[model samples]
Target: MFASPAYAQAAGAAGSSSGSTIFMLGQFVLIGVIFYFLLIRPQQKRAKEHRATIDAVKKNDVIVTAGGIVAKVVKVDETEVEVEIAPNVKIKIVKATIADVRTAGAGKPAND
Candidate 1:
């Protein structure tokens, strides 16, 4: 039964248990920061820009819905918009569902 003192000395030189825990926590924090920048921030920015685009909708602006329906805006309300997908046929849609707004251009064709 030989228990060498060098075994205890080797264990002491390996690493601190608390330091490994702190390093693991630092890794988690770093992952969170990367996710915030890579996923969360860009999505919020796109939402903000889309909101701005929706709010700026006006009569005669061409807009495409999230459902891929391209229509010309007939009337703009606070929360709803009137869009004509076809001649003499208009439908009301929520403002948030509007995906893109094309500004009024010179002699742009109507949805009719």
Candidate 2:
């Protein structure tokens, strides 16, 4: 009788172990889904929008560079832009460095 009890307990432990493994795998899958929706998806969307903005940059547009410099786009080349940060102060920056492009008269003061 004692030997039979030992066998029954062993069988029950095997079933419970498999059930716990399934539950653990399910928890991992759920966490991965949550991360994709909450973190990865939104980041990809923003990157796409930023790329569109960078591509649409043109002359005379107000742009903010990645280095935090705000200037006017003097010329838009195939891979670079010449920005005039001040009176007669121009610099050629890579197209990818253009962080944001503001429209004409968008950032100027009303009284000016």
Candidate 3:
């Protein structure tokens, strides 16, 4: 019931060389395209949206940091921002660390 190693390898390689190598190369490209669309494309889109969100932040905007701290923007600089976490308590954080920017009416009580 046992086959020699050399015989087994030759049996496996027998029909494989009859196939077009171009088809194998095309399969790799197809996989690359699928990966780009399913993985890399969405990542790039999210990165673009995040860039737009970070760029639109302004003074008085409420922001949540990547660290999950909520703060009010006090100043906007090229690469950093000053935010007020509490009354008279301000901290400087890098712009890239901001995770979210709240809309105009966000965080305010609706009925008031």
TM-score of each prediction: 0.81, 0.82, 0.79
lDDT of 3 by residue, 11-39 (tens): 88886865757688889999999999999
When 2 and 3 are scored with TM-score, the better candidate is 2
Off by over 4 Å in 2: 1-14, 108-112
Residues 29-110 of candidate 2 have per-residue lDDT tens digits of: 9999999999999999999999999999887888888888888888989899998888788889999988888987777311
lDDT of each: 0.87, 0.86, 0.86
User: What would the C-alpha RMSD of candidate 1 be, to one decimal place?
Assistant: 3.7
TM-score of 1: 0.81
Name the lDDT of candidate 1.
0.87
**For model 2, the run of ten residues with the poorest summed lDDT:** 103-112
**Each candidate: RMSD to true structure?**
3.7, 4.3, 4.2
Error of 3 at 30 (Å): 0.9
